[model samples]
Target: MITLSAFADEISPLPEEQIDVLARHGIKHIEFRSIHGKNVLDLTDDEHAQFRDLLRQNGFGLSAIGSPVGKIKITEPFEPHLDRYAIALKLAEFYSTPRIRIFSFYMPEGDDPAIHRNEVIRRMTALAGVAEAKGIRLFLENEKGIYGDTAERSHDLVTAVGSPALEHAFDPANYLEVGQDIDSAWNLLRPQVGHFHVKDYCTKTHKNVPAGQGEGQIPRLIADAVAHGYKGFCTLEPHLVVAEKFYGFTGPERFGDAATALKTELNARDVSFA
Candidate 1:
């Protein structure tokens, strides 16, 4: 029963029309990226409350707060990031979402990866302490141009943090971006995975494609996670919203195309979205 969700950012800026689109597509859960076209830290209390009310009225639940917490240089001290995390936690409480997506940020130029690695673990652990007390889980997503881009590094960072509050948000296409085989990457990060991102990529061009149309081996990835007993949401972060220049279509058209492809794939594999 892996519930399918989508990022609000994919739909962009929380428009009323987007809610209608999501409702039409039967998308009941969303991981909010930002509120009122700003980061979570910048959202005021009134805006947060209004956002929550909108979701409630629209029959949507906030799957997680997609906070850009700590997605900066590792050399930068943790204090500034901590402030943002605190704000994110408050918003998470307001929205009644139990999870937040965080990052390992970029490694500083000409610095030892080892030092940056330790700093990330230390900072994440401190954040995890606060999150644990607040009853929230911080999920570290592997992204390109970041220290934890690969399965191995992300696993090591999670191991070093050693907090139950900290877990992995697995994204296969991200591994593909860094030139890792999706199957091997999944095997490496299987033990630490707490959530998932559903996306696909063109192996040669490194471009995003519809979920089942790329070289990501999505069926195998989903099967592996199911076999490993991953009982969490497989949220769709479809980067397929960019239209071809020649076609002059909008982002939603691309997203709708991707959604159709994903629905077909899931049907063929007997994976029910509900």
Candidate 2:
């Protein structure tokens, strides 16, 4: 229960290298973010073929399309991004996974996120409709500065959308970064969490860290999730090397460290997992 997966591209941009590193850690699943230094959404038809071949040859499975589908400026045009989301949906279908990780659009600097709520809801509802029609599920990640970044706003989006196709992808580190109360956040978001992300943030150093070693409250959350009969993929977004507002990086060694740290936390919770 509570199986583990990772954004393997953080290990290396090269798909083959990413696979090799994951295999060494006994990981069979990866959040398909990028391969060969290209974003997943940017991959061409030929590239998709090659990516599939590599995954098959290496005995790996995809957890979700780790797409930057809505990581755009909120004030920018929406039509183009909706088209991009269509591409992400196709990729998810092609990879045989209903899981697709996405974000609400980022708010313009110093803009009140609440002011954009109506627009965010409209766009999210549209995307949810597409997923429902196509038999896929969308996991909305709570990235900072986005309209749905906070736990309350995140719950609101899921509630307002009123669709099973759309739900939450819980990330404790992200919550902590915004000074949210984890207990309250968990209580509110728990019912809607479709997937979990593994990462930790150090308040003291203000940097990313391995799970269970910082302000993420990972162990407590894991125990609670399992106690509540929750079982699903906990996608690793280690951000070990170069975590920025938009992207992150980590090599094979650091990625392995990140995976091990998460495994350690799970083990302590007496949770059986890969």
Candidate 3:
């Protein structure tokens, strides 16, 4: 089955409220991003223990750790970021999830992403090494304005890393945002894609919209992924209420609407989700 998971913090900053919203929506897996207004990477040890225990008690399985492990600028120092990743790995272990969503670092302003390609690959290899050491998989998301924004570059990064710990997460809307076609994206990265992010790109506004209501062509992608026996999470990254660079918020109603919209596409294809 194609399972559905969500970055629950989009519903609320409070962990309790996040869980409540997921329960109401029948979402059993969480793409743990934040809780109580703190990023998953910044959670205190005590906080981690308490929050993880709560999830265990509630029977919420984790689909991935939505860590910003590689979301920094290409020019930023690497040592600190790698240290931060240690914490992310700890969280993944705590949640018992093998996958962690990540990014290839953003390029310097006004510089062609290609200029930093070699550096991006070097850093990505290092990041993949961390996941490989910990027996975890890194799901590299193709975000706009990053080194791996295009499917082609994303494919290159994962290929260069050459580790099962390194993989891809296809966000059709993200590809559209960067003027990359979904067909080519799916063709090139299909072998590497571990999952999808449920959001659509708006051609007119150049913003994100609910799946299937915009330029993402989400339904087609879902059908193709399923046809190829891609069993993975369709993680909801709905930026419905507000969109920003670092993070976004959908609130309860908008978040629920986003989930419903993606579910519509899944159901249209006669696919089942957990």
TM-score of each prediction: 0.92, 0.97, 0.96
Root-mean-square deviation of Cα positions for candidate 2 versus the true structure, in angstroms: 1.0
Query: What digit string (tens of lDDT, one per residue) describes model 2 on residues 1-274?
Result: 8788999888988888888888889998999988888889998999998888888888888999999988998899999888899899889888888889999999998988889989999999999999999999899999788887799999998999999999899988888888888889998889898899987898888889999888888877877888888888988898989988867898888998898898888888798786
Off by over 4 Å in 1: 110-112, 241-250
Q: Encode model 3's per-residue lDDT on 133-196: one tens digit a residue.
A: 8899999999888999898889988998899999898888788878998898889988898878
Give the best candidate by lDDT.
2
Where does candidate 3 clash, by residue pair? none
**Alpha-carbon lDDT, every model:** 0.77, 0.88, 0.86
- Candidate 1 lDDT, 20-118, residue by residue in tens: 666777778877776446766687788877877888888888778988886888877778778788888988888889899998878866665676776
**Leading candidate by TM-score:** 2
Local error of candidate 1 at residue 191 (angstroms) = 1.7
Could you tell me the lDDT of residue 267 within candidate 1?
A: 76
Give each model's clash number: 0, 0, 0
